[model samples]
Structures are given as structure tokens and as C-alpha cells.
Target: MSTPILEFATDANNPCMHCGVCCTHFRISFYWAEADDAPSGWVPASLTEPLNPWLRCMKGTNGKTRRCIALTGTVGQAVRCAIYSQRPSPCREFPVYLEDGRPNPKCNELRAQVGLPPLPELPIAPANDPDGTPTEPPTEPPAAA
Candidate 1:
């Protein structure tokens, strides 16, 4: 199942400072079909490089620097994707949150590496729901004197 993505949209709940850490933290590879040259593709064909027969990755990200060509702006201050709308699945599918609306742990790790802060975890869901698991451990009832 596909995860919901903001795709250059600023989130009020998990506001990103445009830290750009994630852009430089990992390789961004996606299926070749996502490139503009392919049928129904959107990612800019010129911005990608072939990884294999079936895979492609954004330029700059494949090299040692790991920064994406599409990213522009000062990391941790202001930044944006050059091809937000036409970005590949790896970009669009990157998650700041989980299916139940909680922050993704991995996203925070990249941010921390750059001296940025972690996204705050959301309030617990209703205990009855599978997503309702509390972040904090349950407290013991007051012991009777």
C-alpha cells in the first residue's frame, strides 16, 4: 500500500524545516518507469541516471555527496525539491509519518545527523485501535497505604 506523502507541502503537524538532511543521507533509487521518458512517468528524465536495467536514481545522490540535484536551498534553514510534482516514487513515497499518523523514526535519524531536531511523535491513538499504542509506558495505580 502506498503511504501518504506531502510532496513539497509543508506539514502543520510534522513541520519540516527543510533540513535537507534526508536528501544527503541516502541513495534515492526508483523504478525506471517513473522517469519522464517512460509511459505515464513524471520524474524529469534529464535529472536521473540509470542504476541498472530497471532502476534509476537521481543524480548527485548516487555519488559520494549524496545530495540530490533537485534539492535547493540552505539545509536546516530553507530548502525545496526542484521537481516536487514530477519527482520519482522515492521522493514522493518518503514519509515523515506512519500509517497511523505517528512520526517515522528513520526520518528523525537523518535530521539528527545534521544537528536538526526529531519530529515529535503524535498523540496516542485510541487504546482500542491497533495504532493506539501509547508512547509512554502505562503508570501503575497508586499503591494503597
Candidate 2:
């Protein structure tokens, strides 16, 4: 069973901890070799659909909603990736922010599409964000404006 991550610790250090707009905003496709049966990270084949012989995409992401098949819980509140440790390379590489603490343009664009505000270019949950992104997906949307 997929245990929802349930809740995240929100604080002054992280602004994006509660938002999950990007997981439903893009096509999460990756090389077929990235599947569980391969040499490394284990995205399950059953939760994916072939995009091409060389590429497979997370099931929900290839559809109209674009939500990843492994994503759990609500989008603007708490959410988790059911197969987080085994997620494919594309997910592992999608940055919420740039290396210098600027918000990723694509991330902000996706958030805007969902009525979530743009992640700030500076001071966006910087603690433990080695690559300018949160280690976990955002856990809550910004408080109502």
C-alpha cells in the first residue's frame, strides 16, 4: 500500500514545502533502461507506459492530467512520491530552483498554471537545498494571498 507522507514540517526556512504543482504539470518520460529491472533506480514498469521503444513515461503523466502515477496525497497540501527512492532520472533532475538560489523558470511557470505563486528567486527554502531545490516536494501551498 502507498503510505501517504501525510504531513511535512513547515517553517520559516521553506516556502515551497506544501505545493506539488510540477508533478502534474509535465510529461515525466525517461529512458526505458531506467526501470526497476535495470541496473539502478527502480521505477516500476507497471506504472509506466511506452512513449517510444526507447522511452517510457510515468502512467498518469502521459495522460491529460499529467500527474505522476506514484504521487500520493493532495496537490496543494501534502503529497509524496510512492516510489520516491526508485523514481526515474527526469524526476531526480527536475530542479525547483537554480544552483545559485534562483527559482527555476519552469517550476515557477508550472506553479503559476495551478494558481500557486512563483517561488522566489532568493531565499526559497534554502536550508539543506544542495542543488537549489528542496530534498522533498513542497508540502503546502503558500497561505492564501
Candidate 3:
């Protein structure tokens, strides 16, 4: 399913701080095509397990947390996908939003967990970021109840 671009303003302060929460919190599903290519240099050198063509589940090593093997970087630092450019199609399109041009509620949950205020409602679009990540809708600031 192709995600339509929602028109919304970019939050200047909403830069992805690379908290790695997105990677650690979710099980990144990979496509068959992504597994065909050789692992990137950034992939952990110690991991010799062959990529499972039908791999579906992803969990952190040593019971740390659930995350994609391509996710790299230190906690609270710069975290990013090692093979971002060549990431699987599913990985390239995450946080699926509604077709009505509304932001996915799940995204708000993520921002809250990451210490970010709710984002303003915005349209979704094909993220053209250099990282090749998908563009998410701008969430509204949490209501001041």
C-alpha cells in the first residue's frame, strides 16, 4: 500500500534525536529482497547468522530489547539504520497512517514515549530525507487540560 503525503509543517525541534526507541521498541520486518544483499559493514561483525528468507520476528540480543539488526548507535546518542539506503520496503514505510490525511495515533504514542509533545495534525508524504526514511505526520501538541 502506498502511503499518501499529508500536508503539514515540519517541526524544527522535532528532529529525530536518534533515541533508538523506534528501533528498539518495534520489530522491524524485512522484505525478501533486502535479505538477498550482503550485510553492510556496519552490521555487527560478530553476527554470523544467515538472514532467514522468511524471517519475520526480530528481537534484541541478550534479551536487551526488540530491535532490527540494522539498527546501530549508542543509547541517547545518534541511532540509525545501518542499511538505511537499502532498507527493506516495509522498513522504508512505517507508522502507517489513515488514508484521510490524518496522522496515525500510534505516532503520538511514540512521541509521548520519547518525551516529545504531541505533533500538529499534518498530511503524510513520501519522506525525501537523506536517510531515506518515510515522512511522518506532524502531531499536535498535547492538549493543555
Q: Provide the TM-score for each candidate, comma-separated.
A: 0.75, 0.71, 0.50
Which parts of model 1 are misplaced by more than 4 Å?
1-14, 124-145
What is candidate 2's lDDT per residue for 1-145, written digit by digit as tens? 1212222355323444356676787888899988876687388989888898899988888877678878887776566677876878877677665655566787767666656677654443466454555355455445543
Best-first order by TM-score: 1, 2, 3
Candidate 1 lowest-lDDT run of ten: 136-145
Give the clashing pairs for model 1.
Answer: none
Instruction: Judging by TM-score against the true structure, name the best candidate.
Output: 1
After TM-score superposition, the amount by which residue 66's alpha carbon in candidate 2 deviates from its true location, in angstroms, is 1.8
- Local distance difference test values of all predictions, in order: 0.65, 0.65, 0.45
